[model samples]
Target: MHLKKLTVVALSACFGLSACQKEEAPPAAPPASEAPAPARAESAPQQPVESMPPATATAPGSGSNLIREPVAAQEQPLQAIQTKMGPKESVIHLTSAKVTGQILTVEFVAVPKKRGDGRYEWLNLTLPLKNVSYIDDATAKKVSLLQDDGEAYMASPLNGTGKSIRLDGHSPITATLKFPAPPETSPTISVNFSDIGSFDGVPVSR
Candidate 1:
């Protein structure tokens, strides 16, 4: 009886140790796709973008800038003629005629004339001005004023305005008219001032 009890105790101890070993065994290996991924490296910082500057604007030349003066103000010594004008008449006297290179300059003063309405009008002339050139003694051909590329006559501006000059009735305004010079063979030329009539034997100096 004692031998059988000892055999039973040894078998029970062997079974308990086997059950503990089975419970403590490691878990089954997971599938390759289910495994945790490796960690990623940190990225470098981004740079900032710069903006461009705006363009600058430019201006064009004004009317005053384009006007060229033919003669200086001081060089022209104006004289006051006491003689008056009659009604229904416009008077212009050729004071001086000067030939310089290819140009012939004629300086004249317009006498304050009485209008047909009996009102006295002073000299008021416009720019890019035009005048009558009826004769040239040298060529015997009618000479015209020199024209620029813009078709404007090369003449002094009426005033600093590049426009017209307006003078008071009491004061005489001396103005200049330029024409293409006649041939050097003639020291004088006849200029017909349209309705004002022709000024013959007008002397030309250098």
Candidate 2:
């Protein structure tokens, strides 16, 4: 049996547990310091590699330090669901689950209902922090996030620079997570998020 070996760090664990419910809900209007900067124009994202190093943190005012751009999230997800994250009502959209070589990349977006202030607040989607994993429908085995040789998770980091990944209260938040490829016989899996719920029958593509 494959164990759930990805240990959630204290800071990340705080975002996933109910005990930190208060922290999950951002302020009605995000503080200016917490706002995401404008995304600089860049070349289209290159194909993903088998592994990637953790993003290096820079001075607080510097922009995002994400190593690569994620695949553009689709206008429509393969599946979507509504759920509550703390006091906020949010929708989780599962966009794509594609296999490339030995890696399976899962992309999703989190859309929160506009706060009374009419602005979205930051939402943390750091995979490792949330104990995100998936179960193969065929074998009933759990698969954890892929990590590099140095043991750093290959998923996108918080805000692309922080210790954990956070979605700025820009528009909806899109996140990509990498995992080991599933069994050849399995064409779908159930993705499990810590405090968020599980999404089953999620189709897989090669």
The TM-score leader among the candidates is: 2
Give lDDT for model 1: 0.59
Q: Which stretches of candidate 1 lie over 4 Å from their true place?
A: 1-90, 113-131, 156-170
Clashing pairs in 2: 157-165, 158-164, 158-165, 158-166, 159-166
Model 2 Cα lDDT, one tens digit per residue, 26-134:
6645766445543222222332231232223344224433322233344344464323352255666777888999899988777766777988765544333447789
Candidate 2: Cα lDDT at 116 = 75
What CA RMSD would you report for each candidate? 17.9, 42.0
Model 1: per-residue Cα lDDT over 71-158, one tens digit each = 4444565443222332234455567788899889887766666667866666453322445574767667887666567665555544
Query: TM-score of predicted model 1?
Result: 0.45
TM values, all candidates: 0.45, 0.52
